[model samples]
Target: MVVAGRIHRRHFIIGAAGTAGAVVAIGANGVDAPALAQQTTEPQNGKALPEVVSWKDPDAVIVHTELTVETKRDKIGTSGITPSTELYLRNNLPSPSEEAVANRDSWEVSFEGVQNERTMTVGDLKRLGIETVAAVLQCSGNGRALFDHEASGTQWSTGAAGNLIWSGVPVRTVVEALGGVAAGRAFMTSTGGESLPEGIDPQTVIVERSIPADIAMERAILAWEMNGQPVPLAHGGPLRVVIPGFYGINNVKYVKKVAFTETESDAAIQRTGYRVRPVGVSGAPDQPSMWEMKVKSWVTHPLVDQQSGRIQIFGVAFGGNSAVQRVEVSTDGGQSWREANFVGPDLGSYAWRPFVLPVDLSPGTYTITSRATDASGNVQEEVTEPNHRGYDYSGWRRLAVDVTVT
Candidate 1:
């Protein structure tokens, strides 16, 4: 029973940078069916389908990317959060071989960064103070599937995000063990020659990116197992990079190589695509993408219960660099709101804080919305919050349901 190391704690403020509006607490209100429908619009190019990825059997259905709102609704009653089993899969390339996805063979990962260059198999990685941590891995375009203005790439439903307990070697030790490479200022990750995926654009599939070696060393990891078992091929198998706080694209899968460099390269996903202007800014210059986590929250429990009685509202919040200062809930469509009490104050940034709010329902329809505010006073917005590329960071999530009293 080997366990991976835990994410180190730091003093990161909760919430985002710029925000407006005052925080207020209010009681439940009547629902508006037409208003809710108008707020959520359809994508431009008709309706898109959920792209499914599988390794072993043709029916594996490992991951689905660029999904549409209708597809998400048909699959899961909720959209924002995808289940671990049905988690939409994304790979730089297809599986290297059928055996890699079927056979439960051991794996090996190499560490080549500015400090030191070395290679360690899965067994060796597990022996070095192995630990497991539960964190959220969300695509930068997770909610893009819902945006009225469509992005060129994957039309991901909120389902592009998943929370799993990942196990592997601590990236800090991997970087530190390499005599701490001095020449390179950034860390590069690669995978073995045997495991590259098939049919993927050679240029776009295999991932490689470099961040300040110091930053990568602080939170990087060679993840070998996910959710208490070997990571499925649909996800990254054998090994993957679990860098908390950054977009899912930064966490490269099927890693075969790692390097350290003094200068950043625009060859990888972070350099060219998946990069967007920060929140609240319009037409801002694009910057090299790094793992910048914003304070975000979502409501999961009772997403839409037709047999509604005394429904209990529940969900989780996470901010890698900052702590979730407050999580607020609104049943009146953001016009009025109430603060949902945190499980406690001592929760960690990497760990999610589960919140519970019991609300009594009447014989009518309702819309449940949740918002998060970080310690830095960055409050979640109700709409897109007006970003440059229309990239959605943290915003209010609304769940609709109709009720009838017997």
Candidate 2:
């Protein structure tokens, strides 16, 4: 009960040791806070974390489990940025200046607006077949830290988002090899960005758009490779656009052309300004705009700890079609709740699953909470509905820590 600078709610407890009457009946009863943490550490790979356990009774808690970092290279000058793949290669863009990345030898992939015109290459797209998906490419502002009111271009704090395996060729096999599309229409594509960083202008990089063409030809693709290789160039090299569930600004990068048309090309980045605020609507900041995606989660461990039940609680959860189903947890910050055990095999949709909760705390001063549910029923809403370009998703994410039972 000491809220001055924050971090103080009386703490510590995970039980069954000296059993002072079961730690006062489980501290008068209360425990449960999970659904995130543990995998993302690399003090140069020495690996030696775990020392954060606070308890004075905000509900005594501890969580430490996160370590996942790999390196690829080339995203910018100095190669600066690193926090588990730097927000999935700084959100993607670059490629398509009359395409010619030092000669992939001879590449081609044009397919103009519907019912005619076609073109292909890369060995005729590896013989016009070969598909191999595994999707997950988020960046609809990922979380933009609940927008915080304004000032952004990409300060991205929660590590953007990732998950791959993508192979390529689809957009309903290049809009049925460019000879189909009559009613209603939409599917313009036209990727390629990055070239504006120096002196800006080249028409500010160029990124086209258009959708609905039979749902963007059944979830676009064209991806030339990833998690396998040859797709580097800070990600999205040779060819891009996975669009599985949408986001990552419709997944168009370096792509080149796919058009199909029916008119709806406001040009990528969701029609010019990266858009937001249009879910339920709020003040009147000039309405009308769309491009959904608003569920997010990230807490990667204690970030700093001491002792208690040792500790363990991880992170990673995303949404579009959802599929987390359940993952509740609260260590006395949200009052009470339990259920944090989802290691893998849910594979529902929009990937990004990794969770852990194996604590034995009892030292005091805790605050952690994680909740999720998806599969269309959508249930991650604790409170977050007030847009104006804010773009924050279903809410409720409070994490604090400290412990030392001795």
Candidate 3:
């Protein structure tokens, strides 16, 4: 279906989700998203926010303090899908002017990685094909706060991730329509539309990333719509690249360029930034680029004191690049584990599922944490290794918090 105007939220949820347990599907299928506020008083560096991300729920999302803003963990509710208004914001450069995206049909994105090296407008791309995918968009530095060393970037906790529906033209459809990918190409590099300021090194601050070609061809999309609405400006509007099973950085916002290259782009974001290295070592191309995500899960409910009997433990879990097999809850801090049943519909392999384990408790302080297992048999790491950038801190123990049941 070509995106003519206002795509309904219901179509995507019912069509995209595969039923899991008896629990009803939340997110798009559950209920209408909360309305966005016209005003905000959230502070950033003692002053008011630079700009009002009017589309975002001011009360639900946090601003400043962490690179951009992040969502409150509790606001990242049990709903399998995150509403656009409630999604977190993380950006390297500022969003383009409203004029740039005012006429969505006029927006042009050049395709230079294949035989049909031509530029196509957003309207042109929309006519190609329509597909929907549910995947988790998580910051590569999501668990940075959990790391022992002070990570340089955002101090994101669990709120940095969200499972949402993306409706767009399949990258494969575009590639095939444009005569397929060029030979000798190993990476698919996508560029954001955010304008760069004069004088600064473009390479240092620009947002461009190149991912493995095979993965891009198989799972990437040029998303013009997000969470059932035209992609909002705050969350990358007009169009953005959606690469499932990859970190949030890989999903370039305000995307206007797609290229096939034999080698990874020398773009700083792809070259030195977002690289994982030792605590003392500087990021280099040789070090791993924070691309594929690791299997992980963390408790969202019971963050505070709870009642003694019949309490349900709730959290979100996902298999980074595979299906989540199971999630184990450890009340004794990882000493022992019990399987938890999934409460929402299985949103495919890449998206996270809400899980629950109802347990009766007596008055006492109990530490709680959850571990996830992916279809590949990869279990969530017990502790994160020390790194200079403090990326991918999957240690379940750090997520452990005490809650007194009375």
Candidate 4:
């Protein structure tokens, strides 16, 4: 995949002129300026960084203006598992170096706040055991583009999510073997080893975020594989944390360290970012961090301008921690609804379930909406309150199409 603003190893210093130069000039005693410069200047064996995966069918997805990738609503329901190539990409920072991606085997993950406090390699993790699970990985800010409040972040729609099968060792097993977590630690903060650009202070950068310790020990996995293939560089190769039923932000990619803390991580990404607050409200402690995803569904079969006599509309529904009980489709702007037929076997609680509805219509304009009800009875809201960060939008999915019965 070719990302718009591709950064090469050679370009690190030049690209980060302002930040790198400032860091070099400051040369703080505690900060390792020389090491930072060395990292920036090191050549990647003269090889360019790997290109981030891009959509083969441009029409199949919507490429954000900022290059944050998202699949198109109409192209999503074709398969129960979203293809690795078709999966959306969301990166808080630039991609890691090609060298880093190539030498993944040597990478070690350190675990802290445990009785043993040990480090483990991917091989060690596999030796313990391999477990595969199908789960949804969704951006917290999905559907932000549709919000009327105009939040400041990636303006995503329904395509900012996908259901994929992941293969890895359960986090609980790993933690238990490491002498188990110490008491009083309620959060597990994970960090990636990816190098940062020149100008930014490594300490200030928020590469890590914390999740509840219970969730980490329960449903989280140290995933190294995606859809039977090794995790791609763009999708956090080597290893990543996959927390089923949680938003994607908690699934830290390129994981290097897992620290058990008594309190929530104060990293910028954890504290100041990804919070659900009012448009004007801004502060770390005031806003709540986004966690479990809300029940949501989208119409994917009929393209916006699709023309047909008998249209079959289908989409995927996910209820985060709960199983989706039913999905209802409305043909008349949600004035009424009809239960849609589920199309596939239930993968799991974390995986999305597909639903389809067949409708016959003459030439006219139509608005279609889909709402999902989970086992917990959490129904998709008709409207979601707009937040400052555009996170956790779980409203009824809607689509407008012009049908021509020729």
In candidate 4, list every pair of residues with a backbone clash. 1-54, 19-199, 20-199
> How does residue 371 of candidate 3 score in lDDT?
96
lDDT of 1 by residue, 1-406 (tens): 1011111111112232211111111111222222233231223333322322211111112224332121232232222222344345555444455455454445555665544566666666666766676666776665554454545556554445555567777777765666766673555544333343568765554466555566677776778787666775557776777776666666777666766666654454545545566443433115636456667776654443233356666666666456667888776556678888765434345555666677777655455667888777877655553333445445554222222221
- Weakest ten-residue segment in model 4 by summed lDDT: 4-13
Number of backbone collisions per candidate: 34, 51, 0, 3
Best by lDDT: 3
TM-score of each: 0.70, 0.30, 0.89, 0.84
By lDDT rank, best first, the candidates go 3, 4, 1, 2
lDDT of 2 by residue, 102-123 (tens): 4542566677766776667655
lDDT of 4: 0.72
Candidate 4 lDDT tens digits, 1-406: 2121221110011222243222121100222112233232212232221245432233344556433677655557545777765567788876676665576667689999998898888878888877898999999988787666667877787778989889899988888888899989999899977777688766467578898899888888999888877787777888999999999988888899998989877777777878888777885745678788888887665544334456777778888889888999877667789999888778899999888898986766566668899999999877666677777876663222222232
lDDT of each: 0.52, 0.49, 0.79, 0.72
Error of 3 at 317 (Å): 0.0
Better of 1 and 4 by lDDT: 4
Q: What lDDT score goes with residue 363 in model 3? A: 85
